[model samples]
Target: MIEKQSLPSAPILIESIRSIGYSFETAIADLIDNSISAKATRIDILSIPNEEPYIIIFDNGNGMNKVELEEAMRLGSKNPNEVREENDLGRFGLGLKSASLSQCRNLTVVSKKDGKLSAFSWNLDYVIERNSWSILEYSEEEIMQLENIELFKDVETGTYVLLKKFDKIQASTLEINKTITEKMSSTIDHLALVFHRYLDDGVEIYVNNRKIESIDPFLTKNKATQAKRTQEIKIGESIIKVKPYILPHYNKLSEDDLKKVGGKEDLRKNQGFYIYRNKRLIIWGTWFRLSRQDELSKLARVMVEIPNSLDDVWGIDIKKSTANIPDIIKKNLYSCIEESVFTSKEVYRYRGRKENNSEKYNYVWDRIKTRDGYEYRINRDLPQIQLLSKNFDKDVLIEFERLLKNIEKSFPTNTVYLDVADGKLKNDSEMSAEEIDELIMAFEDSLNKCQELGLNVIEFYEQIIKTEPYCNNEKLKELMKEKIKKYE
Candidate 1:
């Protein structure tokens, strides 16, 4: 038996790992994970886009010493299976190097601890030329030349990460500034949502000095949000907590609210298990194949909190963007998924019924459940329409009925659904005074017609007060009530 040392060629292996499928946003998030593990309270991301653009991420965390920073810069710094502090978010220890190198040719990190500053950088070109895994250590005077290294001077313990020489990004875009600006814009959104719970807990994350606000998927603070009872699944000294939430019906959600929940187009896509590892979102908008995504269940979102101890069982990948649920966990999640989906459908159904059977007003449209789904048909029997029919001759009345059905059948459900999903639906605000004036004339004409036909004008006005658009206008309803009282 014999043992031989076979080291991978530095340049080839480094270039290969650079293609690890990390999008611009995911790469930024991976670096933040390291900051969070270091117990950073405030993290600042600065991107100066230009011909020679650079990115600097500064965090006020428990900074590492010279020896510690050397080990941190090394690949495979920590074992994936080893037990760590519950708050530590690192796994595989490849995130610092892999994530940084995936975006840039030069990766420099400066840290301040115990009144001493240490700086190191891994330059891809240097590694290739040397044909070894070597990082350049900077002297105190040399370290001062690094961008944003002064950021650590004010703090006793903090780290500053600098990224430069975006060769990969420059290769794809002619307008480097515009491209990096766009990438940073999306990276802000990704951090806001992925680290939303952390942001909500007093952690400050700034991009270009602008504070980033958390985007809570469940909208738990909303008055209309329905939160189901939480269920715990215990796995040998560990607990995975599952809490379901049904977002408010779309009508109750304003356009601004839609954006917070991933925009209208993605509302359905973002509905599912929001898996969080120690309050940090790992993967989301999935049912783990426990259920399918559908219109009825679009508002259902289940928050699953699993401690990192169960990382092995969940099969959390290096990127933390994916996790596989064991069959045992999947079985336990079935009932939770079913309940959340059913409740979400009830919210949808309730919105439909709100315009149908509620005692407040007579809805002009009837929501009918079809084999495929629900259909909204005009309620031809609405009192206003019924009274108008009496004035028509037999043939004319029949044609009028056909006309209503045609309008119903020609309903642009698909277009309306898309518009609503995109948050582009027309807002139903109070009508202007000019619009109300027009309604007045139309109401007076109908009232006069009722008198001429030997019909009860007061009774006619009664039905009008309880019907569609008229019922929605308080001013019109008041005027109609006055007319009815005058007749009485």
Candidate 2:
């Protein structure tokens, strides 16, 4: 028979778990996950940055009883392999302990339920001093002595997690208030982004008495944002939703609008795939190595929504900060990349027409590279250009052709290429509500002209629907159908 040996000392094991990689922001986020899983509608974080700073997070969640509280403090409280509730945001069960202990030496959790309060704590200093695994149960009087513990005095049910002796966050010799203020800014932004969907659904998060607001990366509410048709992919029992968005041209956005979607990073760097697990953003700003990041595709962002059930399929990690897109979805996404990229380029190329008086040009100029170097050619068959050419005299036409050739020769192809490669290309576009309205108005006028020319309504509909601008709009096609039926 083999004899079982006890694990390492309690202090050694506890300290080891604390060393797991968790930044100040991520650690707080992990605690917030617990608050959410507890069905908390309101979460308040209070950090007092004195010499002996304490970070307190209190949530109006389903507070645990004495039995449940003890169980919750146990290491590996729940198996990662075990099935969990659909809304539960935890895995490995070590987040509460490891995340809290990473920054502080003492972690105290106080709960109020059924008009009674219970408090418990895990102190690394106590463990090291006693050399034993033990939990320190606090008396109601003792708990009340702690700063901000009075918050739960009158509440019916809620949980408060207090982190004391913030060694990691206060490591620097800098002034405590300044350090805390600087870190709070990033923490606020991260919490707003990670819990954006929750915030939208009416969950309130307050830090230092200030409420946190959600920042929508999709810009879905903006009238100028272009949405591609949604696609769905199945991975076993789970269905992953995919929706692509082309953000409005920068020129159309005010300064405040820019900061709301872009945050502190340049909007270009914030592009690519945004993975949301249960409507909370986890992995983002990546293409999963399927394609390179291009300036042209900066306006292109793909939203991939996955339920918590697919956590294993997507390789969700302990921190829940990163994930891998499954192989099955990769093929479909790659196949659609070309079309998405083309739409993105069109958004980039169409820049200056947002202004009311700006002249709109729809010239498609192809730049070709041969062994001799580069050449540019305008598509002379374009309807607008062809119509203009009919009004030119012979000598005037010769001069026009010479001018087009001169413009092509001076195209600055290499300069443009280098600028795009260096991420210096200005991402402004001519697309706006005005442009779409003008397009529809022009199509309606053209239909009236064709009617006066004695063209058959059906023939006119068939030809016009296949032409520029009209072909791009499905609603316009339906409108044309209505007009043709009215005329008949």
For model 1 the TM-score comes to: 0.75
Per-residue lDDT over 14-69 for candidate 2, one digit per residue giving the tens place of the 0 to 100 score = 98888888888888999999999999999999988776878899999999887788
TM-score for each predicted model, relative to the true structure: 0.75, 0.74
Candidate 1 wrongly placed segments (more than 4 Å) = 360-488
Residue 252 miss distance in model 1 (angstroms): 0.3
**Candidate 1 clashing pairs, residues 3+ apart or interchain:** none
Clashing pairs in 2: 350-430, 351-429, 351-430
Error of 2 at 173 (Å): 3.0
> Per-residue CA lDDT of candidate 1, range 191-266, in tens?
9999999999988999999999999999988878888889999999999999999898878987878899988789
